[model samples]
Target: MTEHLGTDGKNHLQRLASLRRPLAAIALCCSVAVSLQGCVEMMVGGAVMGSLAATDRRTFGAQTEDKTIVFKGESRVSKLIGEAGHVNVNSFNRKVLLTGEVRDEAMKAAVEREINAIENVASVVNELEIAGVSSFSSRSNDTLITGKVKAAFVDAKDLFANSIKVVTERGNVYLMGLVTQTEGARAAEVTRNVGGVQKVIKVFDYITEDELRQLSTTQDKQTAR
Candidate 1:
């Protein structure tokens, strides 16, 4: 009877051990499922964040910036001028470019002083001519010239057309860009050829050929690494 009891005890222990193995397996499976769910949630959250960031990033080119602020600034600039003077306000990315003719140096200084006080202005490029009031014909012709220059930049094969910003006021063409010297010069030449352009002023941040090559090399190395 004792030997029979020992056999029964062994059988019970073996059954308990078998049950523990299945239970352990089930626990492991549950853990894996929870881990996978967490990973999926993290991935979905990242995708949503990435989409939102992309949507928020500003797109360059043909962006008609809100002219209300610019117009208001222009009006304020005009108010600062003498009766004989004119103020031209051209705003891009919050940087205000002031160009036109004022009656005297005082008027010019006052115009700049007034514009400097305006809110949201990043910086001011005061290129106002003090002596001469620009003729209507001259201004009209400058407009035509600007259109032509813009057309040329847009048609260029080697340059990024949208990256070049053309601002013309009173026969002076202001060129803004993040480009190589060669590209900037080419763009300037194109502007010069446009009819009635009195002068071309460069406000470019130039990227040299060697630096551009180095930048390209670095990018390639990063990609390879």
Candidate 2:
């Protein structure tokens, strides 16, 4: 499926066109939910929701440069749905990845349809598993791992953790960051060594030396401050 998103341009367009309405519906439902729940609750909801949305964009863009182009197209369509802070969206080429909890099946299907409507989306990966809101302990674990992983990269020579985003869910570590081949190997090794990590899946975009240098500089500043 991912390979298709990378090589096949025509299929991507077909998928995006199919997804628009569903995604718009997701945005609508979220907007309504926030209005009913009030600002305080909405803010709390945004924290996790925002991460899911951002992770999708960051992960897909880092995975493939071609997919990044597809993502931009899909994002523009979603923007029209307005900024509903609850639902999260991710797209790679025409493959749309949806995650995070929603209130009902209608919302789920709506999001899936909207993503399918985009011009270049090859397919929609509807991983928006119906589940309750995230718990405090889960969020804390995510924060701890992100901070620790980013910190580890700072001290490790030639390794940049900022290029990697750490997502800890149910003790499993989902690593989404860009890195050079060597840096990725190092990051994987470090993740395995981390206590409480059930597993680490390396989802990274391998970059050239020049890109690595830029990332390294950015990482240095992050580590310093």
Candidate 3:
């Protein structure tokens, strides 16, 4: 049976289209994943993330550039830090967030510089701590905290959950999105209350509600045409 893809207004078809080039790679990985549960989990997670990316307000081109920025940034960080630090690189709409811990101020500065050098990186937020690297247990707990915040946002129902990206490091939660001021505040408020979060930081691109409405209308018109 042949599977046919169609647009359903919420970008489902777009996500499937974006997966075309990777279908071959994904097929190859299916065999390997059968032997490794971790590999299967990674593949499923990446696919889910890619599906979400297609629904992002940023242009598909911008989404691709954001992924490129993270990949290039991580490659450079590995060369710079090796076993000296633990850093997580996240790029949302081309704005890169640097989290985790480096050994010293010098290393933190170096990480920022290396990331800024990545093409299409509009800005870099260096939230990396200058202290001993986090333990594996700590990092794992941070990941759980991030998931909790995202799930909370979905349950809130007042905001488009996909509009925000959450990153957690050492219990600090960072939120990134292109949202209205009201939306940003609401998101921050909800995230701050999520269990295990130590702090909340908002890195949002604010626009008036009218502007957001106009953008949505324009997109609908474009899609209709």
Candidate 4:
């Protein structure tokens, strides 16, 4: 009788362990969904995020460094600007983009100068407008436009959607990517068509078609793995 009870206990534990795996997976999906903030972007970006390390034009090391640069640069810039200036900092492949409004030309120049001094920053594009800080509604609209631009890219079969990072500020759209001239032009053209986009700035690290082909292979290998 004791032996029979031990066998049943083991079976019960095995079943519980089996249940935990699926439960854990569901929990993880929920966590990612919540963290991504937009279910649609998350769904659309799922493929991109999965293959980000593989398919990125920047090498894995460059991608990590770019993220680090953005984190440190944003912290420093936000502190420097205070409430006087509304600044948004974006770092892609070590190049920093400064948008939003500053008090004057001095504040604008200062934002660039400060970010430029950061280590590993290749360059700073200061597109900070001199007008008054934008209202909440304006910024919200910019967010909507950014989502639309990204969704448009996902549907744009001619271009790789994940290759570009889209930023919209005050009706102007800025694109950052490591792509070829053709890809950049294609991306800009797509953005220009998005409603409420006033201007497009291409900040691209142009590569040859051969280089692009080499990068494309990475995704295949990643998938096979």
lDDT of 2 at 48: 71
Q: Going through the candidates in order, what is the number of backbone clashes in each?
A: 0, 24, 0, 0
lDDT, model 3, position 130: 83
Per-residue CA lDDT of model 3 for 18-96, tens digit only, reads 8886997898799677878877889999989766754466777877898888888889999999999988999988899
Give the Å error, residue 127, model 4.
0.6
lDDT of 2 by residue, 187-211 (tens): 8888788767778766555677797
Model 4, 1-225: lDDT tens digits are 436668779888889999999999999999998887787777879867776656567777778888888888778878988899888888888888889999989888888888888888998888899989899999999999999999889889888877888989987899998899899999999999988888988878788999888877876776788
TM-score of each: 0.58, 0.44, 0.75, 0.76
Q: Candidate 3: where is the Cα deviation over 4 Å?
A: 1-54, 221-225
Worst 10 residues of 3 by lDDT: 1-10
When sorted by TM-score, best at the front, the candidate numbers are: 4, 3, 1, 2
Preferred candidate (lDDT higher): 1 or 2:
1
Give the alpha-carbon lDDT of every model. Answer: 0.73, 0.60, 0.86, 0.86
Q: Give the per-residue lDDT digits (tens) of candidate 1, residues 7-30.
A: 779888889999999999999999
Model 3, position 224, has a per-residue lDDT of 60
